[model samples]
Target: MHSRFLRLAVAAGASLGGLAASQAATIGLMAPLSGPQALVGQDQVDGFMLALEQLGGKLGGQPASVLKEDDQLKPEIGQQIVRKFIDKDKVDAIVGLSFSNVLMGSLPRLAESGTVAIATNAGPSPLAGASCKPNVFSVAWQNDGAAEAMGKFAQDRGVKRVVLMAPNYQAGKDMLAGFKRFYKGEVVDEAYTQVNQPDYAAELAQLQSAKADAAFVFYPGGMGVNFVKQMSQAGLLPKLPLYSVFTVDGTTLPSLRDAAAGTISGAMWDAALDTPENKKFVAAFEAKYKRTPSEYAATAFDAANLLDTALRKLGGAAGDAKALAAAVKAAGSEFKSVRGPFRFNNNNLPVQNYYAFQAVKEGGKVVMKPLGTPLKEHADAYHAQCALKSLP
Candidate 1:
C-alpha cells in the first residue's frame, strides 16, 4: 500500500508538471491550393512560410507547428478543413481563410469554438458588420476597401460615365456597392459575370456599347488574368480608362504583361510602397521567390508578423483564445506593418491607407507605378454596425 501510494503521488506530480509547461503554438492554415486560384493560395502560404523562416522557424522565440490544408476553393471543403483543425487538431489559431464564401462557411464554427481566426485574404462584409466575432480579425482590408478607393479615384478624375464588373458573388456585390458609395456619377451598367468565367468578350462588347468613360472591375486570381487579357484583346483598354481593384495586380500582371499596361488599380499595399518595412519585405520576397509578391502575399506576411508580436506577448502560448485575440488586437497598434497605418477597427477589420497604382512602362519594363494615395487612414463603412465597442 505504501508503494502504491508513492506511485500515485509521483504520477500526480508529473501531470502537474506537464500542465505547468506550455506547448508550442499550432496554426492551421487553409487555402485553395488546387484550383483556378492555386497561385493565390500558394502565395499566401509562401509568404507565411517566409516569415516563419526569418523568425528562425519559431514564433516569438518559441517553436511553432503549421498545418496547411487545401480547400480547393470550395465552401464545403473549407468547412470540413475547419472542423478538422478545430475538433481534431485543436489548433491554437486558424489562418488563411481564402475567399469570402469559404470564410463565411467556416465562420459559424470559429465563433462557437472561440478560436483565434486571422484572415489573410477574405474580409467578408457580413463578418465585418453585426456578425463580427471577438476572436475573428481581418489582417487584410475590408472586402470593399480597394473598390471604394477606385471609385473615389474615378470621381476625382472626373470620369462621368463608368461601367462596373465583377464575379456574381457576395464579394462582387459588395465591391460594386462600395464603388457607388464614393462615385456619385452615373453607372452605365453593372455587369455580374459568373465566377471563374473563362471569357469576357461579351462583357467587353457591352461595355463598348455603353460608351462609358471608364470601366471598374473586381476580378481576382485567374479570373483577373483572363478578364484583362480578354479586354485587351478586344481593343477596349486604351480607349476606355480601366480602373480596377484586384484585377491587374502582381498575380495577374505577369500574365497580362504589356496587355495590362495603362490599367490603374486601387489597393491597400503594393511593391511600390515607399516605406522601410515594405522595401525590406519586397526585396526579401523577390529574392526568395523570384517573382513579384501580390497583395495577398503582403497581407499574409503581415498576418505572420501579427502572430509573432501577439504570441511573443503571450510568451509563445495561445491556449487562452480570448487572451490571444486581445493580444493580437493590441499588437495591431504596436507592430510595424509592411502596409502603412494598419490597425484593427472596432469590428476587427483593418484601417489602412489605400493607393492608386498605374501599370506603366519604365526602362522597357512594365511595372505598377504608384500614382498617388486616394484614401488615407481609411476605416471600413460597416464598423458602426458591429456590436463590439472599442477595446480599452
Candidate 2:
C-alpha cells in the first residue's frame, strides 16, 4: 500500500522485521481498506502478518518492511497505489490484491517495473493467458479454476439442471463460465445480479420457479453474507441442494452460521484439509486471529511465504528485479503451502487439487468439512494460451 502514514497503527502491531536491522526488504500491500469489502481486506493484511510473524519478522534473513494502503475499491486509485509503491516506495516486491477490476489498472505496471507481484487472490483470465508475464505469479487459484472444480463436482454427484448465479462482473462471469465448462447438466436457470446488491429475493424466486436440481453462486464479501441470509429466510434453503464457488468461505461462514450448513462449495483449501503444512497454518492462524482461517487467508499466507522463498534465494542479491523475478518464478514450490501441493504453471498460475467442502456443525459451530477432491493436480485451461518460455 502507498499510504504508509495511514496504516502506521496496523504495522505497529505487526512484527517489525527490520526496525533495528540495516538490510531491509520492502513490500507493499494494496487492498480495499475503507470500503464495504474492508473485512476481507483486513483478513488479507492479517494473513500476511501471520506469515511475517512465523518468519521471525524477517524475509530471507533481511528485515521486511511493509507499506499498507487502501484502494477504496476504485481501479484508477489502485493504479496510483501500485505506481506509488514502485516509484516512490521502491518496494522489492508487491502482494495483496482482492479484485480483478482493481488489478487490471495495476498489474501492467508491475510487468514494466520488473517487480515480482505475488497475487494472494484475484487471478484474472487475461493474466493467466495472453497477458502472462514472468514477473507476475498467483498463490491463489485462478478465478475459473475452483469454479471448474465445483461444476465437475456437481456433475459427478449425478445432479442435473443446475441453476447458476453471480454478480455482473468479470470475475462473476468468469466463475459461472468456468462452472459451465465442466458441468454436464443443462443450465436450466442462469442469472447475473447487480454487484453489491443488498437483496436476492427476486433472484431466489426465479431460482425456485426454474426447478433446478441444484444451484451454484459466486457472491463474495458482504454480498455473500446478505445473499445466504436472504436465501435461508426465503425457505428455499431446503428445497434443493446448493453449491457455490467463493460464495461460502471463512470470511462469510461466521455470519451465515447454520444457514450455510449442508451447503457444498469448491475451494483449493479448507481448514480441515489433511496436510502437515495446512495443519500448522490453521493452528497458528486460529491462535493469532482467534478465527478459523479461510481459503483467502490461506492463499495470502502462502503468497507471503512464496516471497520468502524467493527472497531467501536471492539472499544478498536484494533489489535485483530481474534476478528476483527469476528466483520468484523458480521458487514456486520451495515452501510447503497450506493447500498441500502448489506449483506455477506455464502462465504462472497454480496447478493444485481443488476440494468440495460441506458446511456442517462441529461442536455447535458451523465449519467447512472437506468432502473429497473434485479435481486433483488440476491446471488452468488458459495455460496453453500463454507464450512465455519455460523458466530455467
Candidate 3:
C-alpha cells in the first residue's frame, strides 16, 4: 500500500510539472523529484504551484513561469539545479527546497550570485547561525523551533522516557538537539536512521522493546508517511503516545489517512487555524484544488506573497536583482502571513508562534487541529547572537 502511494505521488508530481511548463515568470524549484523522498518534493511543488495560481500568474505585474527540476534528494543534484536555474533560466528567485542537505549544497551559490532564495521549507540551523546570508530567507520555522515546541509540550504533559528518531542529517541533528534543549526528561533511546531508508520495521521493533512512554521523531516527506503507517500496523499508535515535528502535515496526512489519527505534531500553522488571512487562503486553496491546504502550502503562499509585496515596493521593476533583494529585506511584514504576525529575525529566519497539533478526522478528512500554543512571540535562541541592528 505504501509503495502504491509513493508511485501515485510521483505520477501526480509529473502531472503538476507538465502543468507548470504550460505557464510562463520562470521561478525555479529544486526538489527530490525521484527517490524515496519524492513525496516530499511533490508536496513542495504542489504548494508552490498553488501559490503561483493564487497570484494570477504574475509576480510584480509580470507573467510567471516556473522551471521545475528534480534534485533527487542528493546534494550534487541540488547544486546542479541551482547552476541550471542561475545560468540558463535566469530565474528571478528560487523557492521550495525540502531538505537541509540540499539547501546546504545550493545556498552558497545563490548567496554569491545575490539571487533571492526564499525557502518554503528546510530551515537548517546553520543558515540561522554563523552561515547566515542576506540573499537567503526561510518561510518555514527554523529547524529546531517545532521540535522545541514538541519538547515543551512533552514536559508540560509529564511524559518521561521518550524515544527519539530522525534521519542522520544536519537538520535532523539540529532538531534533536533543540528538543533536548527544552526536554529534560530521560530519553529511553536515541536512534539515527538512514536518510532515505524505506522501511522501519526493525526500528519499530526496537522501539516497542524500549517501552518508552512517548516518541519524538523528525521524519519529513515520504519517511513520515512510511513511519506512521508502520507504527500503526505495528499497533504502537494507540499503545504508546507519539509526538513529532515535521512528520504529520499536508504532505503526509493524506497518504496516512486514518492511520495518522491521534498522532501529535508541532508547527506554527494548521489547515484549521481560524484567522482572517488563513481562512481566505484555505478557502481559496480548497476551492481550487479540492484539497485542504497544509502548513507547507501556507508557507509557500507566504513566499509568493513576500515576493509580490517586495516587487510592488520596487514599482514592479525587477531588472536590478541586487536592488530587489535589498528591497525584499527592507519590506518587512508586508505580506499577510497565514501564521499571524510573522517577521524575520536578524538571521533572516522567522520569529513566529509554535503550536502543538494533533491529527483528527474532520468531515472525513484528516486535518491537523491545534491543541496548545507553546511559543507566543517566540524568537530563536540564535537571534541574540546576530549582530545586525538596523532592519535588513
Query: What TM-score would every model get versus the actual structure?
Result: 0.93, 0.93, 0.90
Native-referenced Cα lDDT, model 2: 0.79
How many residue pairs clash in model 1?
0
- Residues 1-392 of candidate 2 have per-residue lDDT tens digits of 21121111111012334443233555567777665576777778878889988988777666666667777767887787778767865666678755878776777787898876777778888888999988787888888988999999998988889889998877888899899999989999789998789988889889889988988999888888898889888888888888998778888998899999888999998888999998899899999889987777888788778777876786634567778778777778677888888788888889899999999988998888888998999988788899986655
lDDT of 1 by residue, 289-346 (tens): 9999998889888888888899889776667888888998999998889988988999
- Each model's lDDT comes to 0.83, 0.79, 0.77
Query: How many backbone overlaps does candidate 2 show?
Result: 2
Ranking of all predicted structures according to TM-score, beginning with the best and ending with the worst: 1, 2, 3
Best by TM-score: 1
RMSD of 1: 7.2
What's the true lDDT of residue 110 in model 2?
77
* Best candidate (score: lDDT): 1
**Ranking 1 against 2 by lDDT, winner:** 1
